[model samples]
Target: MMLEVAIKHAFGGFSLDAGFTAPSGVTALFGRSGSGKTTIINAVAGLLTPDEGRIASRGTVMLDTHHRINLKPHRRRIGYIFQEGRLFPHLSVRQNLGYGAWFAPTPAGRQDASRVVEMLAIGDLLDRRPGALSGGEKQRVAIGRALLSAPELVLADEPLAALDEERKAEILPYFERLRDEISVPILYVSHSASEVARLATTVVALEAGRVVAKGTAAEILGDPAILPAGAREAGAVLTAHVKTHHPDGLTELEAGGIALFLPTVHAAPGSRLRIRIAAHDVMLSRERPEGLSALNILPGTVHSVRPGDGPGALVALDTPAGRVLARITRRSAQTLALSSGATAHAIIKTVSVAASDVGAAAAT
Candidate 1:
């Protein structure tokens, strides 16, 4: 385990009692506001000493209320990235990053600055101050600064929430690189399902200050029952490789022996990627339909059907392209006779898969 946390704290009228183990790769704390996502991360970073709890990273104990062994924030060796870049406005990007490295306990513990710059592609902005950098560029520099600290773990508190959509897109690839290339474990906080689908390796879902579900990204996001935001945000992350780019501006991807066509993907052939397909965007049919404009279709069997309190239903299907989810009206589900062991076809329009929902797959 990379991190183990069990904490309980109460502030004002709200109470938080959550615990989970974070393995290697990015572990995301996912939930809505006031769900104690930030509180859990703060406990890990020593920003807020919980009323009573224990936190350990890489087997080193950072907090143990029972034993009264609490390490100071700096002694914990945690690099924290806030929603904003929080870079020094007066210092150049290079100096800002150096500030983090200077805090390393030992000279040998400092990360190579040049390599960090190259990984985040911030060498060009080293001479510029935070005031001169864009939102995306500033966030990149913030990430570089954190890496230079040589910390055992990195804590990102909704790092992309402060950015616009365009800036978020610009910064997401850097985070992907961080997850794939960096060996350090990450504890990230976010409420966006799309962000979780695109970046998280393991997901710890919180609701009302409690952990409701914990599993792989595919397991948490593909199942609608546990999602706090409900069916609209439920989706599946499919791993696919770019097979071809057609003349009609469609990119062809091969996923688990199934072909999926999507709007022009900005990746080279053979590049592996993760695609997030929303449950609401998928349509179910008993038989393979013909003469349709939709370019993607996969045959699968119904794994389960869950009827919501409302008029809708969520269906899970076991397909060649991994698990697929569909949200349809209960009336429609009965008319089509959707149930466990029933065969069906998942029809998806190429254009329904948004550009922001696609991301680079982590290297195995």
Candidate 2:
């Protein structure tokens, strides 16, 4: 599914003139607070009609102000999951899920209760009421309810924002499963960088109600100029296959003949995984450093250097492992005589890598 949007609207003191395209899988509408993420979503949802614009998904027009086409929210075949689950406190989980089926204009053609329960791992909580469930469980029920409606698209606006870190981690893999296994496209809104790194397939980045960038997760995240930490946080995404697990609670992965050691991941050998390496954590050496504790060192060459706003520079390298980025001081780069096509080695300290930044499953 492809979603195309162009909208113009003003509320209070905020004016939103934004547009973008979203491909299949999970497309994240990412920006800081009040950047018009919710405003654009509301327009597509038919909750707030834009002053002028077109919103189309897979050739179906959800809103076109010029043509006067506006489908009612219920008739749009779009499921919505808010930050709060919004499940009925008085209803059992089963009944709440059944309510989703009842609201569909057409029968979902027999609800797959068991399938949903198993997929979300909510079978045990099926008999409980919303008040009796934990935050993570309630969110799972909300997701199941949305899926039971059999929507062509699902819009989630900061669905994980209300949860604590542990709860967020608990619910994230289920989202990954939904992204990998479900057929419907999802439009997710979030401001957290970690959430975008973990769940987005395409990223539509916005700032102050305008689109700053839009593309695949790797492309957007790898651009140093656009990252929050500027050159410091810019990094590369490597697709690897699990090779084997070490007895010391670490897993070794192979990508293009290069080996990487990660703090034990859940995938079995041969499973493909995408790993993110931040530029700040990488150091470049002209010759292989001796007696260093850093475990992963790969041969590479300087690809290019982009000047930054201050003392540091964004250096891109083509490594045997894949692409690796490094942020080095101007003096360090000059002393090393780093230039395009210069052969070098990227020294990555495995211990410097944060466990939370390593995504074990698919990322947006």
Best by lDDT: 1
- Deviating ranges (above 4 Å) for candidate 1: none
Candidate 1 vs. true structure, TM-score: 0.97
Provide the RMSD of all predictions against the true structure, rounded to 1 decimal. Answer: 1.2, 2.5
Per-prediction TM-score to the true structure, in the order listed: 0.97, 0.90
Error of 2 at 345 (Å): 2.8
* CA displacement after TM-score superposition, residue 331 of candidate 2 (Å): 3.3
Model 1 scores a C-alpha lDDT of 0.92
- Residue runs of model 2 more than 4 Å from their true location after superposition: 11-15, 108-111, 228-233, 360-364
Residue range 1-364, candidate 2, lDDT tens digits: 7888999998788888998887768888877778888998888788999889999987899998998999999878888999999999999999999988786666745347788889999989989999999999999999999988877788999999999988997898888888787776789998876677777888888877888888776677766556632344467767788999999988899988999988888878988777778888889999988999888898898988777779888788888777878888888899999999898888888776655555655642
Local distance difference test scores for all models: 0.92, 0.83
lDDT of 2 at 299: 88
Query: Model 1: per-residue lDDT, tens digit, 103-135?
Result: 888889899888899999998999999999999
